[model samples]
Structures are given as C-alpha cells and as structure tokens.
Target: MVTTQERVGAEPDFALNPSGQFGVYVHVPFCASRCGYCDFNTYTPGELGGATPAGWLEALRSELALASQRLPGPTVDTVFVGGGTPSMLGGDGLAEVLDAVRSEFTLAPDAEVTTEANPESTSPGFFTRLRTAGYTRVSLGMQSVAPTVLRLLDRVHSPGRALDAAREAQDAGFEHVNLDLIYGSPGESDDDLHRSVDAAIGAGVDHLSAYALVVEDGTALARRVRRGEVAAPDEDVLARRYELLDTWLADAGFTWYEVSNWSKPGGECRHNLGYWNGGQWWGAGPGAHGFVGATRWWNVKHPNTYAALAEKRELPIADFEVLAPRDRHVEDVLLQIRLRSGLPTSLLDADEQARAESAVAAGLLVHDGHNLVLTDRGRLLADGVVRDLLAD
Candidate 1:
C-alpha cells in the first residue's frame, strides 16, 4: 500500500521537481459586487477603484514569467482562470493574460482552459472573443433560478439572464459550459432547489456544480445566521436536497463524478480532477493557492502587495508548508474518496485499511477490489468519515 510516509519520503521537494504534470490557475480578483456568502479574495471597483486592471495584468504577466523561470519543464495540462469574476476583465485583458501563458509555458494542444464568470457580466460578443483567445470552457455562476433565493444570495442577475448567458456561450462555440448552483440557503425550499436543477438541465450545461450553502465564518451569511436574521437549514434537509439533486441529475444522464459535481459523458472539469488526484498546479495572482506535489503555497492576499512583489520580479508566495508524509496520504485518501474514481487500497496503511473495512461494513464505503469509494449516505457525512479514517 502507498502510505503517506512512503509518498512524502520519496518526494520531499515535489514542488521543485520539473517532470510532473502541472496545471495553472490564474486569479482575477475583480468583481462587480461581492456575494453575501463569498469570502474569496475578490475586489470591486468600489473597493479599489483607483487601481487599474492594466497594471495588475502586467504584474501577473511578470509573475508568470518569473514562475516559468523558477519552475521549468512541466507541460501544463489545464488552465483555470477563476475569480471574483473573470469575465469582468474584458476580452483584451483576458487575451493578454492568455498570451503570456502561451509564451511562458508549454500548454497541451487540447488543454482545458476554463474561466469562472457571473452571468450578469458576460457579453455575447465578449464570450466569442474569449473562445478565440483559447478558452474552451466557461463556468457560469447561476446560484439559483428562484428570484427570492437570488435576492437572499444578493445575486444581481435573473434566471432568464443566466439562461441567456449559457445560450450565448453555446452559440459562441464553447466546447464545454458549466453551471454552478447553490442550495440549502435560508428560506430555500425543495421546489427552489428543483427549479435551479431544472434550469441547469434545460440550459444543456456540460457540467454542474451544486454546492450546499455553508455559513462560513466572517461572511455576511454567517453573521445573519448567528443573529437569527436568517435560518440555516437542518442537516436532514440538506441531505434530502442533495439526494434529490443526485437522482434528478443522474436521471437526466449526468454522472456524479465528484461529491458536488455532475457532468455529461467526457465533460468533467479536468483542472479540478487534477487537484483531487494530487497532481501539481501553479497558482498565480493575489490570494491564489498552489499545490506542487507535497508542497503547497499561496500568494499574498492583498492585490497591491502581490502586484508589487511580482513587479520586483519575485515569486509572490506569501506563505507555504511542506506536507508531512502522513498529511499527504490523508489528503489523497480524503480527496479520492470524494470522487467516483475511489481511493486505491495502496494509499492506506494497515490501520487505515482496517478502518476502511469497518466503514464499508457500516455502509459508509464500498470496497471494490483495489478501490474504496463513499456511498451516498457516506457522502452526506463525508467530513466525519474522513476524520474517522484518518484517525491515528
């Protein structure tokens, strides 16, 4: 079995190794407005109106150049441009950033380049331009189709607009289009969740990411929930909602590849799959995180600071930690269990294997020869299951 100790011991500096499969993540920290539940490092013009995207783009280009020099010789298999709202950066800005990537790295001919965008920000012409710029995939944030739920989430776009955006993307010749939906919000009913799912399927999305709303600490949602201004759904309700999503999407011919992701045949997000499989990826821009094998690093959170560091021709890495062998193994097992691929028996030690057997007997996991995967009930309590399996 491939224990965490063995993997970590063999590759102490996996991040520095040049011959590993590498992915790229570019963060665009600008958003027209922040969602109440969002805590990602995103800035709005109101927050940083004085700063121009031109300077930030140059800084990002410089950072990519420096990263290319430092980490030489890995073919980039996927590129994900995630953001406060990547679409906010008009076509020209995206083109410039993509151009820099091509010049600095070896991108696979069929590399899946995806960008996260809000439906309200997309322009039909702009999406076509993005396609010409080499972006093959687009993930639109269509949190909910219900107007009340949209207001609760502070989303600016309506259901019709979101649908229009998806249609526009398809018309623009995007090979793959994904829709992100959030469920279990305060006052969100089963009907509301079903409506969103129906909308996603009706839109003919290649991929769907349906996440349950979690009251993250420090977010407005959390504050509201704590103050009783908003009520959090019970675990039972959330579980029922998730099960409904699975059954409905599966019936619609979408496969549940990951716990929260469903896709049509051959439509899974390759970049995300790389992450779950413990592959290497380089993250650029403010507050972006990267995992190069066992070593994980993140850039500075402040946009200006990150830009200044890159402007000085330095890697903007603010903090980093090299994972211990056990940590890496635990991560692998945890991530693998969340997918249909399942965790290999080799990844567990004797103790972990025993625990897995117990979990399978308890109906939390299914053991298929060399692989162990979470069952539906197990997925609902995934965090608890991971903790139990990883217990020393």
Candidate 2:
C-alpha cells in the first residue's frame, strides 16, 4: 500500500510542455449526509462543525493560486469538480471555484469542464448558472431507479429525481450529460436494473457509467453485511447483472468505452480520459491527489489541516513519490487495458509480449495487429488478466 507522509517541500516540476493538455481536479469534501456504502473523504455540515463552506472555498482558492505559480502551463484542457456533493456548494459557489482556477490557468478553446452533482441537489437555476459559468458537462449520481435499491444503497434521491435532473440539465443547455449507475446492490433485482437503464436512456443522456457495488471495509454497508442485516449479492448474480447492463446500454445506442463506462460517439468524458491516458493534473482540496510526470502525491485528509497549509501559502501536498519504472508500467497496463482503444503492445517487453500472446490464445484478448484489445470475457476478468500480464 502506498502510504502518505508529511509534505516534503519541493517545487512543482514545470518542465512540462507549456502547451500540453493539462487537467485540474478540485475536490469538494462537503456532503449533506454520509451514505451507508460511501467511504470517500467527505463530511456533512454537522460533522464538519465550524469548517464552513466559505472557509473551504477560501482555502481552495489559495491552493489554486499556489499551484498556478508552481506549474506554469497553458490553459487547462480539462477540469473536474467531484466529491461530497459538489452541487451542495450551490451554483454560485461552484462558479467561484471555476473562477479561482481561471485566475491561475487559462481554459483551452474547447476545455472540457465537468462537475459531479447529486440529483436531489440541483434545480433549473443551478443548471442554468453552471452552463453560464462555462461548465460543459454534468455527471449526476443516479445510482439506481428502484426505491428498494436506493434505500439499500443509502442514497437520498427519489426514484425520479435523477431523470428529472438530467432533463433539467439538458433544458439548461448542457448536451453533455452523464448518469452514473450502480448495479448489484444487495436487494437490486434484474427488473430493477432494467428500469434504471431504461430510465437513463429515456433521460437522453449521452454518457453512462454503470458500476458494480463493492462493499468496502469500514463502510456502514459492510457492517450490515458482516452482521447479516443484508445479504451480499452472489457472484453469479452480479455477473448476470453486468451482462444485462451491457446489453441494455448497447441496445440504447451507447457504446462501451471503458469497463464500466458507456457513451455515444463523441460524448466521452474528456476530463476522465485525461486521467486514464496519463495526462498531467493538479488536485485541489482536502484529500485530493495530483500527478506530474512520474511523481504522484496526495494532500492532507483533514479539511482543517488542509486549510492551515493553504493559508500559510504552502502547497498542501502531504506526500509524494516518483514512480519506479516497474510501478509505472504496471499502472499503464492496469489502466490502459481497460480503455476502449486498448493497450499498445509497444508498452510491453518480449516476455510480457509473450504473455499477451498467451492471453490471446486463452480468449482474454485479441491482438488486432497493433493494440491488444480485451474481448468481452476479458473485460469481465480484467483483474486476473492484468495480474497475468504483469507476472514475472
């Protein structure tokens, strides 16, 4: 496990091409409430005590100002505001966040700016302002459309809210809309997932991200499963659900671009593509992570500490490591293989290339003369395939 240490002072590497495609990821750690299945670094107003939204925004601005000076570059090609509930900051607050980013970096001619918003937290005014503020995309956390599934996941939105939010965003002039779905919740049925998919398609979203629910340790859901309050979905059942989701999404005119992401042609989330394709980015806010070249680092997890660092005009970087060549290669395989363009064979060595060939023979991949693309089955067993490809 990569562990964090105290921030070791160093200048951000400005050796990057000034005109390169750079991304900015700003984290908003505030949420209305904690969901049972969530373990992300997020806090509610009650839990946050005196750490008001205004203070957090102030600290974020300080970090952005500092980062802009440290890493001089052309306008950011993409920016993603995620976590807690970004919409809870309200449209004006979100606009302010973007404005701070603008003060430091210029936005590219077609910069893909995205924000992840919860369904219940948005309105017409909110969407209208977001578009006016220059946001190009909105990814709403729809989770599931079934009330039972929503309750099981501890999601607060009503069954129709996500669809309603999607329509509202479109009405507000956002053609680039994405709905995030979570399948395999303990009580989620095939029919429930069907409704969810149908509703997402009906919403006319251009992008969809359907993920399998994994009960991570320490989450409230994990505890429920541990105490037998809820049964975990059987592996075979989850597999079938995944197949159903893929079929439904494909029939709805969406193409699988990643393991859990689908999109219409030209509707892919460019900000995410930046991350998967190894582009440089600076992560702002508490518990955010950033990367430049082979060096990756994370900020302090606590909002108070993060605020203190920023107020002191510090980078707020907690720890960083220059990835070893092997580490970088393993990560490339891990991320690139899951992408639709597939992993380039040129990234592998003679031994790994042989392994790739062996994987092809095993029906886990198809070498299309240039790139090694995952077959349908390979995507389902991607973890094992990654391990095999990385094997010594």
lDDT of 1 by residue, 1-392 (tens): 33333442232243555554579999999988878899999888888746667778888899888777767568899999998888888877787888888889999988989988888888899899999999999999999999989998889998778788988999999869999999988788999888889988999888999998887888888888899998976778889999999999999999998999999999999999988988899898989998875688777777888777777777777767788897888888889889987889898889988998999999999987789988989889888888998998
lDDT of each: 0.85, 0.89
RMSD values, in order shown: 4.5, 1.6
Model 1 quality (TM-score): 0.94
**TM-score list, all predictions:** 0.94, 0.97
Instruction: Write model 2 residue lDDT over 1-392, tens digit each, in one string.
Output: 24444345554454454444689999999998889989999998777867888999999999998887777555689999999899999999999999989988989889999999999999999999999999999999999889999998889999999999999999999989999999898878899999999999999999999888889899999999999999976888888998998999898889998888999999999988877877788899999998877778888877888888888998887777777889988988999999989999999999999999999999999977689999988988999999999998
Cα deviation of 100, candidate 2, in Å = 0.6
Which pairs, if any, clash in model 1?
Answer: 2-346
Q: Pick the candidate with the highest TM-score.
A: 2
Clashes of each: 1, 1
